[model samples]
Target: MLDCKPASTPIEANHRIKADMGDPVDKGQYQRLVGRLIYLSHTRPDIAYAVSIVSRYMHDPRSTHLNAAYRILRYLKGCPGKGILFSNSRHLSIECYTDADWAGCLDDRRSTSGYGIFVGGNLVSWRSKKQSVVARSTAEAELRSMVSGICELVWLRLLLTELQLYKGG
Candidate 1:
């Protein structure tokens, strides 16, 4: 891993990612780097938003787009030791939180949905994906994201229930 500078936040508060319609560059290198970042996102939820944003421009990345991706790498260097930590605890309740940005994508006008799922106070799963269909309103987008979250919660609950049964609960 390259030594990188630390960013106060994974992404800029007002930063927005779009299709990089600028002049094309080496597509292979850009795709490789983006793929690495996506894998890193498995352990670093903080970079999820920024990575997802830059991924939209994989087909035609410009200098500006590459710079943004490099910034994330620098941010990662600062928090090299940061990762999900699990602890031994009796509490195994499943809970989740969901949020959405109504019409956040400027190009397609699709909403961005984010959700985090936790078990026994430890984050087990999370996501930041663009909604498939454009939402007519903010409430609609939020509701849809919540529905996705609920699905995750249900699956988690069932999995845990099976685990308990195996342990003779």
Candidate 2:
């Protein structure tokens, strides 16, 4: 989509994408495109959430899903310079921020949880995934996200210690 018009955002905000909404599209093509986007998300955190959403319908992709995937491609074309930046800060501290929405998915009423881990004031790790269980309340959804974030933080701490880069709690 080099010559295609660029999209301002990767995905439309608050747009509910149902699995069985649009007509069926070529499964192989959609999967291959999303697979490439998944790899690209490793370096472009801006498209992580969008890529995750499109990756969900890889098994039985519809036209709606394909359009969303194209929007991500358009977004990438618009902002080619966007990427992660890791600076060498004098002080090394780990900070994780997480958030979740209650019943964000209309199809299954599953809340989506996301977290971004910053090390030395630069984003190092991040993830956006739907919770396995259906949370009855917003508080419950948020709690689940917090637990996931803490788990990642703990893992990162252990890794830093192993590499001799961490000295304090």
Candidate 3:
């Protein structure tokens, strides 16, 4: 795909990954591609959410999943130099935001939760994953996401404490 056209975005906003959208494709190759994307997401937060969504189909990837994977690759190609960028800042503070797609999954109706933690206005940590339990209400879904974020915050605080980066808990 070296000569393939690259895309500016990893996936289209309106795109959906239905379980039975298309014919089944090679599972091994699809899994490998998703694995590489997962590794890349460590530093490329822009693609983290998209990669997480695509990785869900590793067991039985369809042609649609393959296409979505290709779109992510194209996105990387278009923005070859895109990655984490840290700026010089004396002040550091942890600010978190969380959200959820209440029962957004088309097949089993599992909600997806996401959180992003920013340090001094720059993103430092993020996650996007399917919720363990099905949330019956939007409020419940949001609470679930907030709980995940709080866990991350607690861990971050502990890490900072161990490193002596923060003065107090």
Candidate 4:
């Protein structure tokens, strides 16, 4: 897919990817592609959410899942220079933002939670994963995401303090 057309976005907005959307695809191929995407997501947090979605169907991938994976590749091709850039900053305030889609999964009605941790206004951590427990309400889903973000923030704060880089608020 070296010469393939680039996609403007990694995924379609509000796209519901179900298990039975399309014909079955090769499991090995799908797993390999998703594995590579997962590795890439470590440094390309922009694609983390999309990659996580595609990785869900690795066990029994369908045409729809394959297409979603292709979209990520196309997105990467379009933005070859996209990657995290960390520079020295004087400020060290920690900020975290999190959100969740309540019952976003059509198959199992599970919500996906995501969070981003920023230190000194630079993104230092991020994650997008399906919640283990099904949330009862939108507020619950949001709280679940916030809890995950808080855990990460606590760990970060501890690490910064240990290194003598954190200033007590």
Candidate 5:
């Protein structure tokens, strides 16, 4: 997709991946592309959700998946230097933001829970994953996401305590 038109965004917010849509394509190439995207997502959180969506089709990809992969490539080419930026900021604080979509998955009707954690104003941890349990209501989905974030917060708190790095009460 070197000559393809560039996309401003990696993935469209309204686009959803469907397992049973489109014609089947080569699995090997699709998996390889997804693998590279996954690796890229490490520092480019902007593409994390998009990469996660495309990665789900590695087992059996189709034309639509291939097109999405190409779109990501175009996005990457548009801004090769696009990634997280961290500096030596003295301001330190443990913060996390979380959100969930009620039955967002087109295939399973599963909700997607996403979170981002920052330590000292630097992004340290983030996730865009589908929930294991099927939530019956929007409130339930939101609570499930909150629970996940709380678990991560508790773990980080314990870790900070063990390291004697934080003294917050």
Candidate 6:
């Protein structure tokens, strides 16, 4: 990463990635690169969206698609220390926030949904995935995103509850 060049943005805002109908590349290498990026998403939330976008094209990636993935790696190289930091604080509250872009995917016309869950000012979980169904309206897309966020909340609640019970709460 240190030897890679930095990208101006993690992903191109105006660019839309789709299943590459173009020439195919080495399947093994493509999958390996995407897998690496997915692993990196565990700590680098900033690259999650970009990596998710490019990963969909892994079945038949072209030079353009590979370049996009490489750009993300370059960005990662420049910001190696970029990650969430948990502080030693007594505050133990859990909260979730969500947002969505209706018809965000240009190719399939599906919406993009994102969510972030935090506990005591530390981001515990986050995600960005395209909705399975195409939403007719922005409100509907947003509602779908809220549902995803709620799922995260439930899991986090259960986790925190277990921790509390272990501590004899």
Q: Highest lDDT, which number?
A: 4
Which is the better candidate, 4 or 6, if ranked by lDDT? 4
Q: Who wins the TM-score comparison?
A: 4
- lDDT per model vs. reference: 0.84, 0.93, 0.89, 0.95, 0.87, 0.83
TM-score of 6: 0.88
Which run of 10 residues does model 4 get worst, by summed lDDT? 82-91
Q: Predictions ranked by lDDT, top down?
A: 4, 2, 3, 5, 1, 6
Q: Please give, for residues 84-138, the per-residue lDDT of candidate 6 as tens digits.
A: 8989667767779999989977779999899999887889899999999999999
Q: Which stretches of candidate 2 lie over 4 Å from their true place?
A: none
Whose TM-score is higher: candidate 3's or candidate 5's?
A: 5
- Each model's backbone clash number: 0, 0, 0, 0, 0, 0
Clashing pairs in 5: none
Global Cα RMSD, each model: 2.6, 1.0, 1.5, 0.8, 1.3, 2.8
Native-to-model Cα distance after best TM-score fit, residue 138 in candidate 1, in Å: 1.1
lDDT of 2: 0.93
Cα-based RMSD of candidate 6: 2.8
lDDT tens digits, residue span 2-86, model 1: 6456777767787766675456668889999999999999998988988998888888887767878888887887877988999
Error of 4 at 130 (Å): 0.3
Positional deviation of residue 97's Cα in model 3 after best superposition, in angstroms: 1.5
Per-candidate TM-score against the hidden true structure: 0.90, 0.96, 0.92, 0.97, 0.94, 0.88
